[model samples]
Target chain A: MSGPTVLLTDAAPAKAASTRRSALLGGGGRALLGLLLPLLLAGAWEIAVASGFATGRLLPPPSRIGAALWSLAASGELWTHVAATLIRVGLGFAFGAGAGILFGALTATLPPLRWLLDPSLQALRAVPSLAWVPLFILWFGILETPKVALIAVGVFFPVYVGVAGAIASVDRKLVEVGRIFRLSPLALARRILLPAVLPATLTALRTGLGLGFLFVVAAELMGASEGLGYLLVDGQQFSKPDQILAAIISFAVVGKLADTALVTLTSPLVRWQDTARETL
Target chain B: MLSLQSLSKTYADGTRALEAIDLAVPNAEIVALIGGSGCGKTTLLRLVAGLDRPSAGRIALDGEPITGPHPGVGLVFQEPRLLPWLDVAANVGFGVSDLPRRERAERVAHALERVGLAEHAGRWPRELSGGQQQRVSIARAFVANPRVLLLDEPFSALDAFTRKDLHRHLLALWEEVRPTVLIVTHDVSEAVALADRAIVMRPKPGRLDESVALPLRRPRDPAAPASEAATRTILGALDRSLRPRDAARTPELAGGSSF
Candidate 1:
């Protein structure tokens, strides 16, 4: 038994390495193929335009989009709109995340409070953020309030649902362990439940940030003079697709930045996730 | 320092898991609760751990009846059940936060060292192998320096080699701390190997069937040939309990060799 076991053990590692090498090669090949796809599509689009199968106004070339990006950067107009959009989204996210997490925790812990608050909140959540734009204009009269409110509404639900679900999903065994350790209810919640749920809440925060960016653009499109969304509208009316494409590229860039920042903010809490995924 | 007076449990679904059971575990003694599937061994362990309430009985630790989980009681479940978000050291220090920070760090380090996992302190639950994870669970239980440690089939999921290694390590740890231990297990060999006194339990409205004092001495070598005789003896008793007619008729049997 020992001899055969020794033989198998010695052979297994080599077999495992070869298999892993082949799997990695296959995965890398697929990744290279995926990277080439967007360039292929852009090249095809340019060819179609050259062949007169599509008009330049209908489908702008990648080169034109690049030129628009350079022009916007040179004029400093992109920076102005980007800064305005960032401030609004930041304020909306901070307010919405704070309020939503507080109410979500209360609702999750107290059944009576949940019964009173959840249905109304669910109804509020059902109304699209854009639908609230007109209502907010009626209330706050179309300044920054409507835009911020729209983004805030977009931001709230994800964080609220995330916090509540995280709290509810805490392991009963860990709670029991806390009880055995004689931890107070507050202590248990702080030490065990809070830490356990933080990863989910942070993930929700990242997702909410992305949603806020999307809605910031949408809200500006509906009515605003100072944001990337407004830039898109201005570009469309003036027939400057370059400016439109430039605003869109800037939006994508900002969205990526916000995502990266949120991930950085929550990195410490999710360090375990990083290490676990590292092995694979 | 633990006593159960007429401890019985009936599930909400009307199945009686345990019925009118009386048990006492003296301080620092390791008692193994052994039985087949659905025999209420886990129920007994849970009741003692205060994870569940008895349907119609009382459990007391050192005289006072327990209404809820008592402090200084550590429990290790079948699965490691380590919180996925925590590293090995954090998982071990999970319940010991009341101590000073320096002392907590020392205790966490010591516990991990005791389990031979000091090198793996920064690893997450997913990073470690199953046996290593279970060892971390054991370290978590022991880190509290609990007065009463209850293990419910803790090694059941492990392979035979890892299970044996853990049994030896557990006994070594028990000798050091000497908490009142009550282990629940279905494997007769495991019960016989680790226990000082093995209590056989009957299934379906479960009750204590027989209690046998292990003939093998403390710090017995699990790999030694001398241990096999004692193993056979315990297995023989377990075999008798498995026989349908005799188990139903007698309900309690001792000092009989069925094999």
Candidate 2:
């Protein structure tokens, strides 16, 4: 038993190193595999257009969407729309996620506050993000205020739920350790509670960010111009399928990029956590 | 010195976990409370550490009554219980936060070095093996330089070899710091090996059954005849403590089986 245990323990580090190396080696191949299906769909669409099976004017071939993107970029229209949408998302996400974390922490820590707030907030969360569009437009008008506020409202619920749940579910044993050490309530929160809940909260923030884009699109659709949502509406009004496809594709790319950026930013904070992995 | 006077603990559900437990440990003495499951060994340790209040009695450290978690007491739970976010050095320094920064760092370093984990100061708790993590927990408990150290089956989770190694390490640390130590464990050999006195406890409204003094010299060998005899004595006491009062009157069971 001793001999085998020693051998197994000695092999563990080497096994971990090999696993890390394989992960690094497989990164590019995994990314390529992810892109394969989308590329196949685009190719098939292009072939169908070329074979005249679908009219290019109605469906817009891959080439036409690419050309639309190029022209939008060259004329600087793409940057304006992208920048407008991104600013709203950035501002709204900051406000919503910030408020969510604050209120969630308060409610989770204080039983009376939780009792007073959680039920109403949960009910409000059940209402669709679009339901607030007309009300926000009427209250704040068709300016960026309504759009940003709408996005904020959309971003708030998931983050609040995530943070509250995470804080409530922090390991009781760890909390006992803190109490045994005689940590002050504030010190306990700063040292134990915050770090324990961070991973789940970051995941919630990412979800909220995705929802931020969706709400911004809905908000922009109801009101006046100057966003990817505006470009999407403009394309429809002019009956240009290429422009519409261009806007939709850009949204998808931007959303993916934003999610990736968030993951990169949060990975280091939660590096100590033991995340689940797919076995090879 | 640490003293527990008539300490009793009764849950709200009308179950008595401990009853009139009385014990005392002079300064720098090592004592072990040995018992079976549901014998309130952990409850006694917790009460002594000021982590829980006794229902009907008092625990005093250096003649001061313990009302809540006090600086004079340091506790190492059965689990290492190191906060996952903190590195080894930070975990060691956790209980000693009132010290000056440089002093805290020095104490943490000294404790880690004493536990033979100096090089692991920057590693996370998860990166360490179970034994190493337990060592870190010992480091944390000792770094505070408390008047008393409470260990609740601290080595019971480790494999036999690691457990032996930690016993040696714990003895070394005790020799160096010489804090009054109360270790709660069910392992008879462990009590015989590390403790100056082993207090046998009985279950079902836990109470002290007997106390056995170990007169073996330092660097005691677990396989030695004296240690084996002591282990047998404690086991015999524990077994006798477990038998029903009426059974002791029966002729056939009067000469109970020896361990």
Candidate 3:
């Protein structure tokens, strides 16, 4: 708030240096504070196991969980389960996203299509994806088909709604400019509509990935033989807590990898957005 | 040449925009329609552009009845309205979608060079200054090589210096292209400086209030000694037209005024 004259004075450098030092020190203190709770929980868990209040078989120690992960890796069972889950999720997600984009675009561009489909879509989105698991199993049997169908249903609605809303909300001024230029309907959709809706659709893609995880776990819990989700449920049934903990860790790693893939794929399309928001 | 004969427009809510208006735009002449806000200046331009149909009357271009947007009419709106996703070159070439890819690229490049933005062809609208983006919009209209150019307050958003510079650029382009132009603006000085004929309009069942023939010398300088007198005369006429009916009787005007 002071004048530029004061900012340029001899004392300004010393004041600025002290401010920087204190801010760094404060951040270090907060980091240590954040670690205290996690450290205390780990310590108590180790103590409880030693005291025999909870047996190692029922509630495994952190070291036991780590050993279980290494053993699973050595046997190749962990990799096989992870690959199976990924294939199911990937195939289901690809089909769901493609269909969602086509239907969403069709509804947005044609008023008659929108009027016909909007009510049914609204009704479907009301039911949670898990609710469809039973019906999917009944229709397709307790095979891979049921699990894949559940994941697809879960992924579809968010992507469809996101793309449709983005298209419908496109700036009217841009459309007028298109008209002045005499852009054909296909050209207008490709150049004007698609680019405008891309940012929203990208966000929806991420949301669909998350829903795919939920449906995958639900499907595995009910019926499945060889997936990360099945491993977790199987470990629980056998009272082997170490195996369950290892499965959970692998699930988190898969999620992080999927997220990284999407981010890498769309980086070029969103370069403008990153530059615009650099100051913030 | 372009002509509007008894051209009229009424909105869906039945608000009449223009009525029984007649004007002839000869080849290579610039006509500026000046008016208070919502005096059907834009509506008239839209009607001429064939964006909206005239409720009554006819518009003709080059001896043919105009049923839709005239084939070679270039329109620049109040806002630059460039596509945010596109850079300068792409924005300029937007109106020439039918041209082959190679030809479109050549036209876009040429138009950008003409607008003095050859080096800025890769810059987005958000990346450029306001005046620069407006220039790209001007380039867009020019790239189409229109027979008649219609403008709606195209430079009203700019500062004085930018506006003046653009005025020069517009005139230079007009001289080269020799398109019949109709400009709608609220600034009286802008009208007097750019137009051979200025039409003043009034709102509330909007119609033409007055029309004046500008006598300022060719290639008129806005800062010249003669231009100041022209400015005041135009301003006085505008003041009389704007005044309440009771105060409009003391019309001490100097310019040739017609309706």
Candidate 4:
């Protein structure tokens, strides 16, 4: 069970070298592992439809879904829908997260501000995501404003909660370090408060983004004229199962890519975090 | 010189942590504050470091009043408290950011070298062991060249070997900068090894019971006859400090008895 010291020393560098090399290749390999289940299911459905085991009317085959997506892309209809969805999410996230961070910072640092706003905000947060859709439409009317507002509402609460909660839990010991260093208030916020809240802030942003995607679907389903949500509505009205499935797949793909982009962009900021996530 | 004139701290919750602590520490002297729990040793250090305000009286450093955290005063906490976002060099160079870029880099390099963490300058605080992190914290305080440095049980968490090893690094750094130190420690051996004068305190509105001046020279051995004698003397002061109020009379004030 035990290796000699000489043998252990000889094996260590070679093992380390191989593991280092595997790390680069392992990411793609891991991604492929994630695709395995979906691909298997698609393949099984394709064979089932091809063999005429069941009518592919209500539940379309993978081939029919791909064809529907391909035709939409060939005419550039897919890009229009994708762009519309992306614009709505981008605008909503930017507005919501900006206000969230600003208000969160204010409430956390000033006791009076916290006392004034925290209770009302907490009450507003109890309102469900979909429950606000009708109210937002009534407030902003049947236009882009309502859709964007809906998505913004979805993004705001999580970011606000994350920022406030993170600030609340920042280590007082670290703040005392700032005090001992004689950091000015601005310097204290810059050096301690900002970096300390970053990991949780990033998590909140990601969660808010996910909720934005959810609300974007809800927003588009109601009155969107040209979006993936619209495509869902169109397919349902026309009774085209393949087109609906294509829109669903597009949503999954675009949402996942957007999430990956977010993660990639913010990854460097929290590289210092010694999380258990790194152990894997 | 650092002077505390009748310094007292009564918490808002009605606990008088320290009562009328008056002391003057000359330049470059190391004073170890030793006592049992609730002795307000840490509170006294905190008040001196200016991290907290004393309810009564004031502190002066070189005739300058210290109302808050002063640039001339530094503190080492129980934990390292190094900024996790910063590397070892950056953390050590934190208080000295006002220096020119070249000078900051040079000073950080020098401080890292002093702590024997020169090679690990680029490593994050998380990568270092408890002892190494504490050493970086020590370097951080010393690199600023403060006139007074306060350490609140900075080595209580370390293993005995690491603790002894750190004492050497601390002394080496202390030799260079010669900051007046007020270290709060429970270890009698630590006080004996580092402190030029060990001060004992009694709890319940902590007051100074006695101050034992050590006559040992530089690089004193904890096991040496003079060091052991000093340790035993300070220990005697500590024992008498915890006794009932009337019985805490200094019966062996002039003696340095050894077993």
Number of the top-ranking candidate, with DockQ as the measure: 4
Fraction of native Cα contacts reproduced by each candidate: 0.50, 0.59, 0.25, 0.88
lDDT of 3 by residue, A47-158 (tens): 8888988877677877788899999999999999999899889978987888788888889989999999988987998998788877887899998998988888888998
In model 3, which regions exceed 4 Å deviation?
A1-61, A274-280, B100-103, B243-259
Inter-residue clash pairs, candidate 1: none
Clashing pairs in 3: none
Q: Model 2, range B1-259, lDDT digits (tens) per residue?
A: 8988999999889889999887878899888889899989998988887777889999988899998988889899999999888899999999888899999999899999999999999999999999999999999999888789999999998999999999989989998889999999989999988988888888989988767888789899999998999998898888877987554442222122233
lDDT of 4 by residue, B91-176 (tens): 99999999999999999999889889999999999999999999999999999998999999999999999999999999999999
Regions of model 1 farther than 4 Å from truth: A1-64, A274-280, B221-233, B236-259
Distance from true position, residue B19, model 1, in Å? 1.7
Where does the lowest 10-residue lDDT sum fall in candidate 4 chain B? B250-259
CAPRI-wise, candidate 2 is medium
* Model 3 CAPRI rating: acceptable
Off by over 4 Å in 2: A1-25, A275-280, B245-259
Q: Quick one: best lDDT, which candidate?
A: 4
Number of the top-ranking candidate, with TM-score as the measure: 4
Model 1 per-residue lDDT tens digits across residues B43-119: 88888878788899998888988877777678998889887778899999988877899999999998888888999
The alpha-carbon RMSD values of the candidates against the true structure, listed in the order shown, are: 5.4, 5.9, 4.6, 3.5
Model 4 error, position A51 (Å): 1.1
lDDT of 3 by residue, B144-222 (tens): 9999999999999999899988888888778878888899999988987898777776665566655677766679987
lDDT of 2 at A2: 100
Q: Which scores greater on DockQ, model 1 or model 4?
A: 4
**lDDT, residue A133, candidate 4:** 80
